[model samples]
Target: MASTRAWILKSRPTGMPDMGNFELREREQEALGEGRVRVENRWLSVDPYMRGRMNDVKSYVPPFEVGKPLEGGAVGKVIESRSPHFKEGDTVFHMYGWRDQAVGPAEKFNKVPPLGVSDEQWLGNLGLTGATAYFGLLRVAAAKEGDTVFVSAAAGAVGSAVVQIAKAKGMTVIGSAGGEEKCAWVREIGADAAIDYKAGPVVKGLMEAAPKGIDVYFDNVGGEHLDAAFATARNNARFAICGMIDAYNGAPQSFRYMARVIAARIQLKGFIYTDYLPEMGDFYRDMGGWVASGQVKSRETIHEGLEATPQAFLDLFTGGNTGKMLVRL
Candidate 1:
């Protein structure tokens, strides 16, 4: 029997996750069962959402069990298929990530479409990450032309998509990043204003960019960035809460401007991208056009090999990657 390497959860973390929490193990492949397929995973996606899954507590998704392989998203080629839906050499995307190879029921995998981009892009800009930004900014926030929009963690995968989409729609986009280099990249990606949130108070930086007020906010970092958005939002402002990376690793957060939500009549909607699954065709059509026409660009920070997976996940908290972070298997 052939064997494959997989990263398994060894222990749940109390705060920020460390390499000790994961153990790389070799699993011998078993014979394929009826209606099953074997996959040779080529790329693995390490996302912030997986951090929450590491915990034992109940949440939107099931927790990653100790001694078992951790999963997120992966792109792979079907090596063997007993099902009629897929065949050998067909590319697919599935949740059985964090492993060099995986075997599962055919229904567990979704066929990857032939988009004009690399297979890695399907895990990023052309996939869930991109869909998140598309639905979060447009559908949840209801951003439109001529609106002044603010985005936190603007250099990240989801945030960068929001910035470019808003810009393409003729919106005034204000992006907040950790440092000058990231801020410069945000501006280069078509943000009207790029605030280095680490340089000063987020509220101060946001105010300097949009003195009047912002019409929409695409929140990736919560806590302080949320406070700042509340302080600078205009009446009837819309907020799409995609992620609160600030509080992801059990960090304490205080929302001083929470009261402003009521006073300003702001609509704050917290959403998971899966909630918009029915509308994915819209996203593929719109975002695909934007990317094809060069209105939206994709960026990725690659971490080579499966051994770097744990560090890649930890780096999300440190603002280590520019856009989507992937570990090549």
Candidate 2:
């Protein structure tokens, strides 16, 4: 038998999650079972969606149990295998994160392709984050060439992907990030304009960036950003509602311009990546090619060790990461 350390959800969060909501403890693992593989987790993803899962509410995904190990995306190397599907030293991606090791049936993990992208990227672009942007912008929002697109939280993983994908489609991009540094990086990634949301009102920024009005809005941060998008949207503009990071913490916000949605005849749709699973092959082929050709780039803010998971997750609220936030375990 061997021991593994995993983070357990000790309590549901109130307004914002703190270290008090989680517990890191060691647990014993039995020898490999039939059809099983033991993985040494190398990287863990800390995403905004995981916050929704922490609450005991019914939603798209089930909530995290109070006494169980928290889970998300993870990439690992197999240390031992009792199944033919996986072999020792094989790299794989799975949904058993928040831990240093994961042991289960071999089918629980999918083998990572021998692509040039790093293992951590399996949790970011070229993975769910990129796929979310791909389907959200191209499918849900129906972004088109020459269209003006707006992305909020534009320096984060999904938002950054949207900015690049919009450019690849020949669309004009206006990205909104928190500060000057992130806004600069957004522009470097091919955005026609980057708005520092903290510098001024988001609606005012969007107005200046797209004085004629934007054709598509990718909603990542919901509160004022959503209102601004609605207010500044061109007629029949499409809105792809991705994760609303602003409201994920249960913050209360008042909106006065929802009438703009009706006035503009906007098409507002919310989607999950799983809804587009059938189109995943197209996404990987297209996005992977973009990365290879330098048409799109992926950035990550990596934290060290399993113990840093809590802080890394908390950092999402503080705009601590410029792109994807991951923990190297």
* Count of steric clashes across candidates, in order: 0, 0
- What is the lDDT of every predicted structure here? 0.92, 0.93
Writing each residue's lDDT as its tens digit, candidate 2 over 15-125 gives 899999999999998588899999999999999999999999999999999999999999999999999999999999999999999998888899997778778878888
Mark the 10 consecutive residues where model 1 has the least summed lDDT.
112-121
Error of 2 at 224 (Å): 0.7
Estimate TM-scores for all models.
0.98, 0.98
Backbone clashes, candidate 1: 0
Candidate 1 lDDT over 1-329, as tens digits, reads: 77889999999998898889999999888799999999999999999999889888899889999999999899999999999999999999999999999799999999987667679888888888999998998899999999999999999999998999999888999999999999999999999999998899999999999999999999999999999999999999999999999898888887988899988999999999999999989888888788778889988999899898999999999999998999887
Q: What's the CA RMSD for each of the models? A: 0.9, 0.9
* lDDT assessment of candidate 1: 0.92
- Runs off by more than 4 Å, candidate 2: none
